[model samples]
Target: MTSQEIFAQIKKKASFLCVGLDPDPQRIPKHLLKEKDPVLTFNKIIIDHTIDHAVAYKPNLAFYEAMGPAGLETLAKTLEYLPEEVFTIADAKRGDIGNTSRLYAKAFFEQMNFDAITVAPYMGEDSVGPFLAFDGKWVILLALTSNQGSQDFQLIENKEGKPLYASVLEKSKTWGTTENMMYVVGATRGESIAEVRKLVPEHFLLVPGVGAQGGSLEEVAKYGMNNQCGLLVNSSRGILYASAEKDFGEAAKKEALALQTDMAQLLDSYCK
Candidate 1:
């Protein structure tokens, strides 16, 4: 989907919520384990229940990759099942040499047909450029992440006195326009989001680390939002594992609805 289309969906749904479909078989309700393909079944239920409240669905590739061949098959099926109008992100975080990166882009954009794919910029533009070559597909580069380890490299200042992530945001703009490029600014780094916004005011941000990660939705919206309501705040465990019973889907829907309602109000307050 193009950036315009994604923003349109957010307006239509009154939401910019992106549900993370990171299902851990062990954490899912035990009742679902009895199914032939429990992970797939669990994902379908979550999607069905939360689709109305989310504009995007992100399936972290690790969850499916860990399941081996069957896991990959399940991911393929899940992608096919997702509603076409809703954006899809393959949080694969793949980055390598130029040739390898090209193949990775084709894998997700052509083979899998994901609307976007999370990419690592550690290898510079060569690693991320191939993904941007695909028209209408997005490259969500890792910027200031929420994890504890992000302090190790992302925050390190170079001789120019700029943090590594700041350079990533600055240099990457030349590689792709706001229409096809986005940055992953974690929700826990809420206070710094304004700084990020100043660097790339028109680009979108795919923010994780809310809910189960204890990031504040209000703080993120306050600092990160732009005229387009440029944020896709994700909630994974908090919504996915809301319950461990047969009513888990209903519980997930409730969590999503709560987030979507907050997002709707934020959109009205900020975008209007």
Candidate 2:
């Protein structure tokens, strides 16, 4: 979707929430497992339940890739089932040389038709530029992530004292405009968000590490929000895996609604 379309959805739904679909087969409800494709069954139900409460859906590709062909089939089916109006992300942190990157872009944008894809920027411009060639699709570059090991590289100070992640933001912004580019700023890095925002004030941020990861939602919104509500706060385990019981979908929807309600309040303040 285009930036205008994305912002419109955020306004219409009163939500910037992105529900992460990191489904674990073992954790799925036994009743769902009885179906031929339990993962898709779980995703379809969850999508139906939370569609109105969220503006985006991110399916972590690793989770499905591990399940092999059947898992991939489920992933494809899940994509087909999602509503066209909502943004869809393949949380596949793919980055390669120019040729391979082009194929990766085709895989998600043309074949899978995901609205966005998570991209690792370690290989520099060529690894990410191919994905930017597609119009109306997003490349969510990994910056300071929520993981503990992120400090090993992302936090390292350069000769001029800028953090490695800061440099990544500065250098990569030229590869794509706000319409096709976004950076992943972990919710756990609440204080650093102000710094990251300065680097690319208008670009959308796909923020994970909330919910189960214990990142504070209020802190992220307070420091990270822009006039357009330029934040897609994500919750995975804390929402989708809220319950492994038969009522899992209902429970997931309840958790998502709570986040959406909180997001509505934040958006009101920003959009004012």
Candidate 3:
């Protein structure tokens, strides 16, 4: 989807919440294992329950890839089942040579039809350029992540005295416009979101460290929000694993509603 379309959905839903579908078989409710495909069944239930409160759904590729072919099939079916109006993201974090990158883009954008894919920029423009070539699709490049290890490389200063992530943001802008590009600024890096916003004010950000990861939603909205409410804050374990019983879906919805309510309030206060 284009930036305009995504922003429109954000307005329509009064939400920028992106539900992360990172299902772990071991963590899924035991009752679901009786189904034909427990993982797929669990996902459908979550989607059905939380669709109204979310404008996006991101399925981290690792979860499905670990399950092998059956897991991949589940992902395909899950994508097909999602509401077309809600933006979809394949959290694949793929980056490779030009030829391989093109294939990765085709797999997610053409075959699976995801609205966006998370990409790594370590290989520079050639690795990311192919993904940018696709129309109406997005490349969510990793910038300042929330993980403990991010400081190992992303925060390192370059010769110009700029952090490596700052250079990544500055240089990658030339590869794609704000319309088709975004940065993954983790909510854990609360202060860095403001720093990233100054570099690319109009671009969207897919933030993924709230809830289970303990990133402050209020702090994220305060420092990261722009005119378009440029944030897709994600919650995986906190929402998905809210309960281990048969009411799992309902529990998930409750968690999502809580986040959506806060988001609506933030939008009213900031976007208005």
Candidate 4:
């Protein structure tokens, strides 16, 4: 989806929530195992329960890939089942040589038809540019992540006195316009979001580390939001895995509604 389309959905739904589908068979209710495809079955329920309260759904590829060939088949089926209007992301974090990058783009954008894919920019523009070549799709590059290990490199200052992520934001912004490109700015780095915003004021940010990871929703919105309400705060473990019992879907819905309500209030305050 284009930037305008994405913003429109945010307004229409009163939300900027992205529900992460990092399903774990062990964590899911055992009763679901009786279903034909338990992973897909679990996802379908979660989607049905939370779709109204969320504007996007991200399926982390690793969770499915770990399940082996059966895992991949489940991922494909999960993609097919997602609502077309809801923005979809394959959290593959893939980056490779140009030729391989093109194939990765084709797999997610063509075969599975995801709206976006998270990419790693460690390989530079050529690795990321192939994904940008596909019109109407998005490349969400890793910037300042929320993980403990982000300080290893992303926070390191180069000889130019700029943090590695700052350089990344500046250089990679040229790869695509705000419409087709976004950066993954973890919500735990909330205080620094304003600094990043000054670097690329128009781009959207796919923020993780919100609920389960302890990132503040209010702080992220305060520092990261632009005229378009440019933030997609994700809550995975907090929402989807809210319950491992039969009430899983209902529990997920409640958590999503609470976040959606908060987002509506945030949007209203900003739109004013």
Candidate 5:
């Protein structure tokens, strides 16, 4: 989906929430285990419950990949189940050589039909270019991520004293328009988000680390929001594992509603 379309959904739903469909079979309710495809059942319930509250659904590939061949079927079937208007993201975090990257893009954008895919920028423009070549699909490049390990490389400074992520935001911003590109800015680093805002004010940010990871939603909005409400704050574990019983779906809905309620107020206060 284009940036305008995504923002439109935010306005319609009164939310910029992106529900992360990173399901762990072990953590899902035991009643679901009796089903033939437990993981898929878990995902369906989560999507069904949160659909009204979320604008996007991101399924991290690692969880499905770990399940082997059946896992891929689970992933494909899950995609088929999502509503077309609800944006989908493959949290693959893939980037390689030119040809390899092209294939990765085709797999997620063509075969899987995802609206966006997370990409690592360590391979430079050539690795990322192939993805952007596809019409309407998005490349969510990794920038100032929320992990503690992010300090290892993203914080390193060059001769100009600019951090590596600053360089990523500056240079990568030139490769794609705001409609087709977004940066993955972590919600934990609120001050860092202000720094990112200075670099690319118009681009959307696919922010993680909000609920389960302890990132402040208010802090993210205070510094990261723009005129378009350029943020897709994600909540995975908190919503997905809200309950270990049959009430899981209802619990997930409650958690998502609470976040969306908070987001509605943020949009009112910040989206000028």
Candidate 6:
């Protein structure tokens, strides 16, 4: 999907919510296990329940890769269930040599048909350029992340006294336009998002770490939002595991609605 299309969905839904579909096989509701594909069954229910409030869905690839071929099949089937109006993100965080990146882009963009994929930018422009070569696809490059380990490399000061992540934003912006590129700015980083906004004012940011990670939504909007509401805040464990019973779908819906409601208010407050 194009950035214009994604922003339209955000406006239509009154939300920039991206539900994370990182389901753990062992944690799936016991009732679903009897089905031929429990993970896919659980995912479909989540999609049906939360589709109204969310403009996007992000399925982290590790969860499916852990289960091997069957899990990968289930992941593809889950994509089939999602309506085309909403964006789909493969949280693969893949970056490699140009040749390998081309195949990775093909697997996710052509074969799997995801609208976007998360990519690590450590390998420089060549590793990321192939993904950008695809039409109407996106490369969400990692910048300041939510994890504690982010401080290890992302914060190191360069010779110019700029932090590594700021340097990342500086150089990587030359690679792709706002329509085809975005940065992964962790919500847990708080006001750091404002720094990112200044660097790339119009680019969309795929933000994870809101609900369970304790990143305040209000803080994210106050500093990160542009006139276009440039953010796709994600919640995984908080929504996916909201309930362990048959009411899981309903529970997920409720959780998503609560976030969406909050997001609507934020958009009204900030987008003005």
- TM-scores for the candidates: 0.98, 0.98, 0.99, 0.98, 0.99, 0.99
Task: For candidate 1, give the lDDT of residue 120.
Answer: 93
Each prediction's number of clashing residue pairs: 0, 0, 0, 0, 0, 0
Weakest 10 consecutive residues of candidate 6 by summed lDDT: 186-195
As for candidate 6, its clashing pairs are none
CA lDDT, every prediction? 0.92, 0.92, 0.93, 0.92, 0.95, 0.94
Candidate 6, residues 1-272: lDDT per residue as tens digits?
78889889999999999999999988889999999999999999999999999999999999999999988999999999999999999999999999999999999999999999999999999999999999999999999999889999999998988999999999999999998999999988667998899899999999998988879999999999998898999999999999999999999999999999999999999985
Candidate 1, position 37, lDDT = 97
Top-scoring candidate (lDDT): 5
Evaluate model 6: give its TM-score.
0.99
For candidate 4, lDDT tens digit of each residue in 1-272? 88888888999999999999999888998899999889999999999999999999999999998999899899998888887888999999999999999999999999989999999989999999999998999999999999999989999999988999999999999889998999999888667898899999989999999988898998888898889999899999999888889999999999999999999998987643
Clashing pairs in 5: none
- Model 1 lDDT tens row, 1-272: 88889989999999999999999988999998889999999999999999999999999999999999899899999999998999999999999999999999999999999999999999998889999999889999999998999899999999988899999999998899998999999888666898898898989999999987778988888888888888999989999999999999999999999999999998888774
Per-residue lDDT of candidate 2, residues 1-272 (tens digit): 88788889999999999999999988888888788888898999999989999999999999999999788888999999998999999999999999999999999999999999999999999999999999889999999899898889999998999999999999999989999999999988678998998899999999999978779888888889998878999999988888889999899999999999998998887654
RMSD of 5: 0.6
> What clash count does candidate 2 reach?
0
lDDT over C-alpha atoms for residue 226 of model 1: 89
Q: Write candidate 3's Cα lDDT for 123-206 as tens digits.
A: 999999999998899999999888889989999998888999999999999899988899999888668888998898889999
* Number of backbone clashes in candidate 6: 0
